[model samples]
Target chain A: MKVLVIGAAGMVGRKLTAALLAAGQVGGQPIESLMLADIVAPETPAASLPIDTIATDLSEPGSAASLLQARPDLIFHLAAIVSGEAEADFEKGYRINLDGTRHLFEAIRLSAQLYRPRVVFTSSIAVFGEPLPAVIGDSQDHTPLTSYGTQKAICELLLADYSRRGFLDGVGIRLPTIAVRPGKPNKAASGFFSGIIREPLAGMEAILPVDDSVRHWFASPRAAVGFLLHAAQMDTAPLGQRRNLTMPGLSVTVAEQIAALRRVAGPAATQLIRRQPDEVIAKIVAGWPQAFDAQRASALGFRAETSFDEIIRIHIEDELPPVQP
Target chain B: MKVLVIGAAGMVGRKLTAALLAAGQVGGQPIESLMLADIVAPETPAASLPIDTIATDLSEPGSAASLLQARPDLIFHLAAIVSGEAEADFEKGYRINLDGTRHLFEAIRLSAQLYRPRVVFTSSIAVFGEPLPAVIGDSQDHTPLTSYGTQKAICELLLADYSRRGFLDGVGIRLPTIAVRPGKPNKAASGFFSGIIREPLAGMEAILPVDDSVRHWFASPRAAVGFLLHAAQMDTAPLGQRRNLTMPGLSVTVAEQIAALRRVAGPAATQLIRRQPDEVIAKIVAGWPQAFDAQRASALGFRAETSFDEIIRIHIEDELPPVQP
Candidate 1:
């Protein structure tokens, strides 16, 4: 099996690439070659297998086609502009998020003579909007409020159609908010879900924008990578016509997240959190979905951390250095 | 109010154009001018107001842009390839159904320096797929099973996003199967919904490809035109972020339709129906939605016939020449 990872320079994309290289195989087939693509050329990690890194924009005409010259058997489409950036720049958002994804799918169609690659696409929970029910179910419709979410939802629909038409084998997984996201805080309104946990663990103060009563769904970065790998190897027969799915995740309030953080890193780490209110962020977050009954994905063997504590532990084990005496 | 109809040659488009011309105003604004566009030039109907008919394909580059040059106050984007045709020709489907819609939207955005036209787009019930509940609701997710359905669903999402961003005042109405269609029968899988009634009423035998037990949702050609007109004038403030709506439609089985036909046109007219099952069409219609709880559209003043008898009467009153003794 050969593999291609789009957006390989991003955090999840890099982690997924490393994991794939370490495993050296997918669905019991040894990976013979790998292609890592992003807007910026990714750093080449030392791997026994053949690997190529390319800096390219999928939205540009023929760019996607060039990347698929090898026609890698397993393709992970993880590239996207985050929600904040997408909202701020509408043209760029649609260009990269919507047109770019379509370009890639069309490229796959052009490439597929007999070889149909397994395409694992990363969708987002933002595909849903409010006037939402207490808990969103698998059957809930997509009414995306943001440009980014709408783009993801459109891609999911396109993927299903392309898959049904036998152009490619597609699986779309709508990821939960990733708690304890590594690196610096970004512009995402939901960034606080990770900031409070990540900043505190790193001995830095983080602002809590909303009230403790505010609840949300979450999974860790490690679990997200796991989802990609599983989707790549899973039997698509069960998916039928509806190929997109909301992934299972831990549902917790701000207070509960704090409690879990206290348990994981002691009271000292918890105290680093500060209370502040921003109506703009709160209003935006209010429209977001808090929990979902992702029964379809769960029934298909996709799993994530059941509790925020496990999520924190995974982040510490994978991202943080060992504690010094 | 200046208006432009993108698919002015189609049945609903023609009806909608006639309704608009008759009223001479929309939302209390006097009709100023009208531009009618389609793949073929629509016959110039007798109207007091200024009207122009042009032969154009929206999928062709610059066609949508040319229509927008007038910057009409209201735009009816009703162009699309029907289901059977879309499934048969994949590229044509995407080009006309998806890309053409996007081009119109992008043109709207470009034209929105000061003028933002009210865009009333026609969507369809095919957006819902099987593994469906007994009754679908307005909040039901779009899980399109066919290429045409998928294209419509994607357009709905785009319309919402564009509306939210203030690029255009857009409303997408997902019309149910239009029953009692006038003129010749088309190749749509759901064509039987109309053919079974239209052909029989015209003294022609219509094929019944499925059993009478199969139930489906419907609205009349007049009602569909009404929905479009209402959407054009309604205060979009109530719609908020969700601009697309499932129009209220009558839910009835084939047996009920036949009974209604008997009541309206007598046994002689009903007897014109022939039973000849085509496995292909039956399979396609089987996956379609049976009924919907379109509470939103109803509350918003969009109305449809309650009984199939009323529907049959509507066909007689609207389409047929007076009963000749």
Candidate 2:
């Protein structure tokens, strides 16, 4: 089997490529060739998996057609500008996230001259916004808060329609916040959810923007990977009109995250946290959904970490501990 | 009130312009200038009102900026390709409906002038497709069955987000089938619904594709204009996160239409109907949602025809000979 990862250089993209190599196949099919593409040339996996990596923009005219020329059987679409950049620069967001996804789908349709492939697209929980009940149900209409969310919601609509029309099998996974992400805190509003734990674990102080009781949704990186693999292989017949699935997530609060941090790294780590009120960040965070009732994905056999503690443990496993002097 | 009517040459556009003129104002403000734009130059009553017509392609680069330059205080965006044309030529559909709408909203945001306008856009029931309950509730997700529906759903999302940000105040009205449409049937699959009755009334035999029991939604042309004008003037404060709304409609099938025709004009109109099954058209009709729960739209003060009988009466009043004739 041949596999192509469309966003091979990004965080989850790199991990997925590694997981594919570690498994030696996709969906029990023996891997023959792995083709990877990203906006920038994907890092040659530090002498790990034998892979061919190329750099290209998917939204460029005919670029998707050129990318799909090799006709890999499994395609993972994970490329997108983050929320802040999307809201700030609408043109870039629509061009990359919306037009790019459409181009990819059209490429598959244009390529039906030869073959069809299974496409697993990474959507986000951001497709949902407020006026959402305390617990958002599975079949709720997509009311996005940000431009990025709108783009993702639009892409999901295209994916379902394209798949239903038989261009290719498509599964869109609305991933949860990847907790304990192994990196310095980024600009995402949800960054602090990981920042408090990550910074404290590293003996660095971090600021909490909202109240400790403010709840939000999440999933471990391990589970996000599982969602992609499962969606790529599952029988899409049951999906019928709904091709997009909200991946299972843990609805935890800042208080819960800090408590878990203190348990793992002691009270000293907890003491590194400071309360600083930033209403701008708080208001942005307020628009973000706290919980998701992802019954559909769960019923379809998708899995995730049951608790934030497990998510922290997964982070520790993925990224080795700091070496002592 | 300065009014901008996009797609001013289209059927609904022409009627909406007339209704706006009849009212002489919107939201209780005196009418000032009217901006009319379309690919085809529109017919404006410049002799009576301050009307400017521009033949502009909305999807072209900077076209939206050019349109927004007029700085109309309120806008009615009622442009879209019919479903069959949209499905047949997918790229054109996305270009005009999806990208065009985005460009318009973006232009509104970039207006360095502090002039924000109330944009009223026309959506369609095509946004909801198969596996539908007998009555599709207002809260259902837009599981569009066609590319046209997807494009409309995307535009609706953009409208909501833009409204949320206050870049523009907008309302998306999901119109029902405009029964007794005063024109020839175009490529839309539902065009047949109007075609059968219109042809029969014209003493011509009309083809019916689906079962008489097939139920679908409807509103008269008069009601549609009401929706547009209401959307322009309604208090949008109550619609916190929901900017898109499904308009009120009457649910009737072919059998009921024929019955209504018989009652209105005796059996002469009903007997002109022909039963010819077209598999392709039947399949297309099957996937569309049959009815709607338009509570939100009703609460906001939009109303539709009461029944198929009343709809037939409307056609007679608007399309048939006057009482003297």
Q: Which stretches of candidate 2 lie over 4 Å from their true place?
A: A46-49, A59-66, A203-206, A258-277, A322-325, B44-47, B185-187, B195-205, B253-255, B267-280
List, residue by residue over A21-118, the lDDT tens digit for candidate 1: 99999999999999999999999999998999999999999999999889899999999999989999999999999999999999999886896889
Cα lDDT for residue B149, candidate 2:
90
Which tens-of-lDDT digit does each residue in B191-292 have in candidate 2? 878877788887888888888878889998888998999999999999887899999999988898889888877797888888888889888888877888
lDDT of 2: 0.86
Instruction: Give the DockQ (C-alpha) for candidate 2.
Output: 0.69
What's the TM-score of every candidate structure? 0.98, 0.91
In order, what lDDT does every prediction score? 0.92, 0.86
RMSD of 2: 3.0
> Candidate 2 on A1-325: residue-level lDDT in tens?
8888998898899999888888887778887878889999998774344578999899899889888877889999999988999999878998999889989998898886657789999999899887778887777789898889999998999898888777888999999888878788887777888888888877899988888988888998788888888987898888887899988899998999888877777899899999887888898888877887889888999999888888887887788565577
Residue B246 in candidate 1, Cα distance off native in Å: 0.5
